[model samples]
Target chain A: MIRTEQAEVVYPNGTRALAATSLTFAPGAFTVLLGPSGAGKSTLLRSLNGLVRLTAGKVVAEEADDLREPHALRRHRRRTGMVFQQHQLIGRATVLANVLTGRLGYHSGLRTLLPFSATEKRRALDAVARVGLIEYALRRCDQLSGGQQQRVGIARALVQEPALILADEPVASLDPATAERVLSLLHGICKADGIAAVVSLHQLEFARRFADRIVGLAKGAVVFDGSPSKLGRAETLRIYGAEPADNDEDSEEPLQLKTGTHA
Target chain B: MLAPSAGHIGILHEHRRAVLRHAGLVGVIVLVCFGALWLTGFFDAQRLIEGGPALGQLASEMVPPDFSRWRAWVGPLVDTLAMSIAGTALAIVISLPLALLAAPNTSPNFAVSQSCRLILSALRSVPELIMGIVFVAAVGFGALPGVLALALHSTGMVGKFYAEAIEHVDPRPLEAARAAGASRFQVITHAVLPQVLPQLADITIYRWEYHFRASTVLGIVGAGGIGFELIAALRVIRYDQVSAILITILLCVVVVDSLGAWLRKQLK
Candidate 1:
């Protein structure tokens, strides 16, 4: 479980990126943060993994105040897998190699010098299979499409077997179709592995369709927190500065994505 | 009424960028003044006239090439190559640790990194020829002293390159490794090593080839190499032997250059 209590972030120049906002995500829950640009959505996601230090208040993950010390926070970060909006995959490395980086916490010393152990290699391969990129494991990550690269990012996170996954605007750069597919895979993986997921989204439609629960933030504070069905036009207007389309307006039902298959 | 009330804007914005440009011009003016002060009274026509006559006299002594002691020069050329290879090898071994310690981002303490850089700067401050003379006195006149001198000089050079290489590496991988709970050593081995290894190889080989040429010159001070033979040939007025030695040195330099090129390509 990940929780933030009145957590606030102030930049060095006194820009308050996140205000006194508090949020909690249940275990195995797929929660989406819906907001517009500069709404502190990314800041909130970074706070969960202790990537962004809180100027005041506490960030608790797995029942510990994560923003305690620099070194201690780093250890907590290992348990939480983070996906950047850019995918942040090391493009030069092979897909398998990039995925195996997720297991860095498990090895030390000359163990890392030698080739990764067979069991660890198997686990990494299993993650590639789970992401349905087993065929491209040997290929370089730079060759993959934007959607495929995001999947590789998911594969990297899956390899960690993390307790919680924080994806900051995971699909903001992807196309609509590709965005839906990537979100579906992320949702399926989180559900299967029982990992709490906090995915930030700029698109209200994708968040509404996929997120198990939706949280709205405006000016670094949570304005609404409830089920997707309960997210009304008033909250959307407040979060987005414009009324969003009704959730039931779309004809398609909720998507059921396969583990390794594209929806 | 608003259309008829347009205010005249002054030339205030015209000189906004002029301030920085004038600052740069002032900096150049200061440098020129210092350069003029430093170079004042350094040139003399009479000294050059005297030096020119001496150079002509020296040139007149060399009438023809005499290749009599080709065998004698060959041994020393081999010695030069051996000295360079050994010195570069030793230099690489010593500099790797010093470079890692000197990298500000990698080292834990600022003082340690600063001290490491200071030590390298001190080593580099002394000329290689002076170092050779000092080593020869201590070790009693052998190729070992020459190699040690070159190694010490090359250590400073390699350490500088290593520090630069460390600086140029992408910080993202290191950040990720730190986030992954990797120990300092693990982060270095996984994140730092892979990124810089190929570049390290390229620079190391290039330095080795460079030192190969420098080792020949170090032999002039009895540090041991073809330079000793060249000096002897000049003293004996054996221009042929000098020519032979010079040709061999040229060939060796060409070979070293090609080898450097090959190694660089291989690394890529």
Candidate 2:
């Protein structure tokens, strides 16, 4: 299990991205972080792998030293896979080459200069097949569609054989159907592999559908932490800091007035 | 109505002022151009008309370019080509590391990046011809000086281009690599190089083409090549031989440019 001890993040420009908050991510559970934009979802998710250096406190993983130690941090990172919103594949490289990069941490820098071993190649190929992109394995990533590219990103992460997965708005750029498909693929993989996943998402529907547990945030602090069925309308309002638009007539009047003033 | 009309008049006045300002700037530019022409005696129509026959006579002398000396020109031609190829290879060797050091994303620290940039600028401040003269004086008259000059001068330009390419790579892939626990060197090889390889190749080939032309000029400064033979012919008033050498240089340049184009296509 990976956990943070009151970990917080304040960027150099003085933006309080995440308040001092502690949480534990258990193995074999899929946790979804639900929040509005800029509500510390990404900040908290990134801190788990030491990607966002916390301004205060530290992250601890089972059997590992404090993440502040470079050696321990690298070890933590090797077993942690991160998915990005932009899919982040090296566009000029083939899908196979991009997936093989996941195995880089398993070898020394000098050893990676040579071609990967056959076992490693087989593993990358298997990941590609799992993503259902076996036919496009040798094709350049730039030529793939956005959905396919995100799958390539997933394959790259999968080849790491990670114990934990962190995804930040991974489907924010895709269409509704494609988004659902990508999330399902990721959710299925994490379930089958028993990898703990901490995925931040903007869509409440997807979160409620796929999450084993839901953690909600607002203004850099968690407002609700429970199972998806337990997330009441009040809890949703607290997490988003607003009411659902369809039922909020009072809110609609104020919104219209604000836009009128702007005009 | 009166107040609104006054505001309209105020707007029109502002527009008129802007127009006047633009007109004044254009007038000043035209005056400076005429002044420069006058200073250079470029307006002397009488002298231009009178010089036509002199140019015609020079052209006449250059016709029927002497192929008699072609046998001796081969060695110098080869020397020029060799100098350019060797110089470009050496420049690429030096520039890649310097570029990596100078790029803000890859540099170890701000001081190293700034110092590397300073070195590139200092190298670039001197032209290849000037550097060729210095190298010739230092190494004595030979093709060695030409090669040295081309490499040093080209490094300045090639390194800056390479640094720019490296600096602009998509940072997302780098983040992904880092998050995957790849070492810094591993991240660079897998993420950075793959993104910028084609752009870097294009820059190197373009620089090689430019260096080929510059190497010929280096030969004029006692760095032995075809330019040296051309200059020798000029000294003896052998206009025909000079013309022949000029033609040879043009043909070689065309060949080099076409080769570079083909290589760039292959890279793509």
Candidate 3:
């Protein structure tokens, strides 16, 4: 479980990116934070891991009760895994090598220095298999498609084995179909692994399909947080300030069979 | 369709301008080269011709090359080679930390990186010969001074190149390492070092070759090496002995160059 109490983030330039935003994340659920650009979605996600330090209030995440000391923040960050907007895959390294980096926090300084042992290699391979990219494990990151690269990013996070996964616009760069597939993958992985996942998405349909709960943010404030069935057109207009022009007109819309399995 | 205007040039107009610019640049280069040759007296062909026979006769007198004193000369030659090796080795050791400190991203603070860059620039501004003279005065005439001069000179060159190599490293791996909770040291070892190692090896070998060349001349300041022998040969008008030393130096340079190339290939 992760919770932030009146967590506020102010940049060095005095820009208040987040203003007293507070929320609690339930475990083993796929939570989607829906918002427009500059709505504090990314900032809120970064705050969960203490990457963006909060100028006021406390961040209570699993295994990280405090954020005052830099050392403690780093130690707490180990339990929080984050994916970025750009996928942020190391383009020059092999896919397998990139995934192994996720295990860096678990190893000692000397072990990190030495080459990966057989057991470490096996674990990395297993993570690769989990992402369904075992065949491309040895391929360079640049060779993979955007969807495949995002999968590798997920694999990297999975290797962290974090209690909570924070994905900041993870599929924003993929095509509509690919985005659907990736989000479905994320939903399935979170459910199976029993890990809490907070995925930020701009597209409402995709969020509505996979999210157990959708948290809407407008102007750096959480306007709505509830089940997907409860998120109606009025609430979305409050979040986006306009009715989506083509909800029924997506040429490649994902086949929404059933909403996320949750009671 | 838009007409070519003062603010914008057409393809043909730009092509003509480019030709004019290149022509002007070449003209300036030729003029500078001629001016330099004239100032240095290198263009005085008549003066060179007048000394040809005297130079030939002087060269002939030092024949047999005075190899009978091999015992004396061999030790100084060894000393020169050792000076090169030791100086390059020391420079390599110092350059590693200096490179990390000089790198803007890898370095912890901007002030530290900037200060290290400034210090390297200061060291590089003084030539090895000047460094040799300064060291000789402080430490007395010996290979110790030569080693110090070579080491200091190479440190400047190596550190600058090494920092550049560090700067060009891909930031993605570093980000991944950081996100994975790797400490600064681990990030440097896993991401930065591997990316920069090949280029670093190339730079080190090139520096070694350059230091070897510099070491041969360090003896001119009484810093012990074959340069002392070369100076003695020149002072005594034993041009043949000088010629012999020059040939040996040429051979040694070629050997080192080839060896360095081979080692670089192996590293690659």
Q: Which candidate is the best by lDDT?
A: 2
**Candidate number achieving the greatest DockQ relative to the actual structure:** 2
Per-prediction DockQ: 0.34, 0.73, 0.43
- Order of quality (DockQ): 2, 3, 1
lDDT of 3 by residue, A1-263 (tens): 88999998777776667789779999998899987676778888888876677899889866667766766666766666777768877676789988887877776667776887788789889989988999999998989999999999988888888788899989888887888888788778889989899999877888888899999986667888999999998998787666655333232312221111111
Docking class of 3: acceptable
Per-residue CA lDDT of model 2 for B1-268, tens digit only, reads 3666888999999999999999999999999999999999989999999899999998899998887888899999999989988999999999999999999998889999999999999888899999999999999998999999999998999999999999999999999999988988888888999999999999999988898888888888898888899889989999998899999999999999999999999998
Residue B172, candidate 1: how far off, in angstroms? 2.5
Worst 10 residues of 2 chain B by lDDT: B1-10
| Candidate 1 lDDT | 0.79
Restricting to chain A, the TM-score for each candidate equals 0.88, 0.92, 0.90
The whole-model lDDT of each prediction reads: 0.79, 0.89, 0.83
Candidate 1 residue pairs in clash (backbone atoms < 3 Å): B65-B240, B66-B240, B66-B241
Better candidate by lDDT, 2 or 3: 2
**Which residue runs does candidate 2 get wrong by more than 4 Å?**
A245-263, B1-24, B44-51
- Candidate 3 ranges beyond 4 A from true positions: A107-118, A135-145, A176-178, A243-263, B1-82, B134-144, B222-229, B266-268
TM-score (all chains, Cα) for each model = 0.81, 0.92, 0.81
Please compute the TM-score of chain B alone for each predicted structure, in the order given. 0.81, 0.89, 0.89
Q: Where is model 1 chain A poorest over a 10-residue stretch in terms of lDDT?
A: A254-263
| CA RMSD (A), model 3 | 6.2
Error of 3 at A224 (Å): 3.5
